[model samples]
Target: MTFIPIAIYWIIALWGLFSRRPVLVYLFFLSLPFGSFAVVPPALTGGLTFVPTPMTAMLMVGRTFLDPTILMRAISSALDVRRLGLLTGFIVTALVSTVFMPRIFANRVMVIPVRGDVSTAAPLFPTTQNISQMAYLLISFATVIMFSQILKNARMQQTVLLALTWASALTVATGMLDFASQYLPVAPLLDPFRTATYALLVDVELTTGKRVVGLMPEASSFGSLCLSLLCLLYFMRRAIDHDRVRAFYAPVLCALLIAFAWLSTSSATYLGLAAFFAMAALEWIMRFLDSRYNLLRKRYLKAEFAAAALAVVAVAFIMLLHPAILENVSMMVDRMVFQKTETSSFEERNMWTYVSLNALVETWGLGVGIGGTRASNSAVAAISNVGVIGGIFYFGFIIQSLLRSAPPDDKRGQVLIVALRYAFVPTFLVGLLIGTTSDFGAFGAFRYGMLTAIGVTGLYHSSRMRQRRIAVSPESA
Candidate 1:
């Protein structure tokens, strides 16, 4: 009997992997248990109530109490570890790339040929990195692995893109339904829908009404995810330009997603959005400048110019329509610019920054493990937190990657690229500087995790650009 239930989960997981359908994958993820009751076996489902805070911990503990064979049978039978393994490989490669590739490229300074021209440049990111920075680099490497492997297989890429598209669509649908749920009476049949739908809208101030946070923990995170998805949509739109149906819907959906982000009033999210837009603009500007004035035109400058113009206009318009967003942003900038010593949060952050420096000197090159807290006379113990030297290292890596990745010749390009690439930098910097005064290493893994994901995307994009250029050269042609 137990084997039967285990078999079901395995079967579903396997189907999800092999089918390689993006829509199905999105459904699978979103449909997965968000509560302990849903996660519990159907036979035991009725008894569960509280949702676990650390989902992975719950899974591990659940498997421990459950029959080992049953757990193994389910996990091994359904899911594709090969995909996971490939993802791991990509991350490992990224790590190596981060640690050595930059230094090698710097040393070699070879004139690697581009389309119709010879080019030589140093790689993105340097060999020397701080511990916190290393952590983000490693995580970024992992995300790249996932993106590359998934995209490498045509079927998988299609599946992923489709899933991402539909997932984006579904999020929109869920948000709408959530808004509608606020006014209407709930039908028993629509009870589940109501719960799922309404859960997305959040109350920012209990009295001032709720803002839409969606399935994410907060409005800001939700907004950030939407912005990330918008980038994905932009990629999809580029790929599916010929498909009028998808092309039309993609832009509309992207607009809606942006609107949701705006409504959330997450200032940090704007930084990321701005960063991506700035990167897009830089790419466009470079191509345009090259075409108009280059000794030889190597890339499509016209397309870049058009794209950049569109992006700039779209961003400007979004801001123009939402004056409240500007107000919020101004207030935030003012807070940061004229920081006061009176605020306890600000004061504590200053203390932590100093503490991290002290800890760094005490540790002297070796870092405490990721999310480690020691009771002994370690620097972390003395500081009563994750320590600043580590924070500096982690934050430093993000900055380094951005600097290394920016397009040559444009200072604006360099700054924008850094801001986008190191999207988590400001937030983490805020968390370190003003938001949370404590050592956030243990508490704020998500911020680091996001940095990891973004870094991997940037690295993968860099590698792909090189691959595309290399593949199209003389011999391949």
Candidate 2:
């Protein structure tokens, strides 16, 4: 049953490849959030499990080879000696660790508990699963490199952002429908399709009885996706043309996203949202203070101060008249935040982290293998699986990519870059909790890769444009 969608996807992907329309490839990549069907390849059914995203990534590699232009460009970009060195070092270390280190340190079997069930043991070693995981990780890295070359146009960047916005809206709508299914008959109609897409379970809040998982494997994953997209949408909103209808609808879409995030009821999502808003508010406040003093500024600040005063007064009134409301809020926070540390899920994550560190120690900092330890944190997973050397290269590549993508002199672009940079803090924190090195595969890697590529490309073009202007000027010479 899962193979059906996988087969259909390949059919379309092959058509796109032969037709020389790379946009089709890009579209397929963008649609990965909806491509969760899991299938086992007949040839290696016992050894390897195939997911649509990794399959698509392999197809993309094939497409690149078929089109020499893309291959050439990717090769040219790779010629940057430092990036090439880092990438090569990382890949070599991962391969060596996966093949040799595990066998050398074969004295211990690393046990990682599965989520939802604490007693079940999932052991890790240099098995076929680890190899397959390494393959997928490599594919993800390759996809990011391919996209950095392909998504050079500002228009393409806008198109990708618009596509992501639509996907987010759809995810929120489906989630709402899933929630309504508890009380409404028609809502269940959507479940079959969702199930086929690999969303096997619906997560419901115990307190509110509201369903939250949407296309993702779990509620927390869905919430994480929403938070990431929300931050992206907020930063990219200004880039959209104000004269267009999308601009009019953009705020509405943001509101819907915010509502979806809240409805997720995931603590991590709440933290991410809080961080994003705090950064945004800080930026706004700084901007407000820096602007020339005028009647509008004074009135705006005065209104803000008045609103704060009113909020305090209202809070006092509530404390005096409706003490239960404050008590309930505190209880809710305790349940949602403080109490989480006592849950089995929290224990499972901590166990994974502990096992990961142990694995790192067992390997003597040489690493066990990629996917050799089921650590919830990417940094821990990287260090434990690929060794300290590989970890440095892996994280170094990300930092270098971000630095290269730094916006130029354009004020709006610079502001957008700052917002995007701050957004990474929350994403990183979430990754530290329960994210893979590929950041949950193409769903995360591709989106962030495109954003970085777009920023870098835009900055390059901006510099070129300025150079051209200066070259044309007579006074400068």
Whole-model lDDT values for every prediction: 0.40, 0.63
Deviation from native of the Cα of residue 255 in model 1, angstroms: 1.3
Tens digit of per-residue lDDT, candidate 2, span 168-265 = 66666766776676677854455333433222556455675664766556677777777776676665555554335244555566667777776777
TM-score of each: 0.48, 0.79
Which residue pairs come into collision in candidate 2? none
User: How big is the positional error of residue 318 in model 2, measured in Å on the Cα after superposition?
Assistant: 11
Best by TM-score: 2
The digit string of per-residue lDDT tens for model 1 on 408-444 reads 3333323323334433333333232223222232112
Give candidate 1's error at residue 407 in angstroms: 18
Worst 10 residues of 1 by lDDT: 111-120
TM-score, cand. 2 vs. native: 0.79
Model 2 poorest 10 in a row by lDDT: 292-301
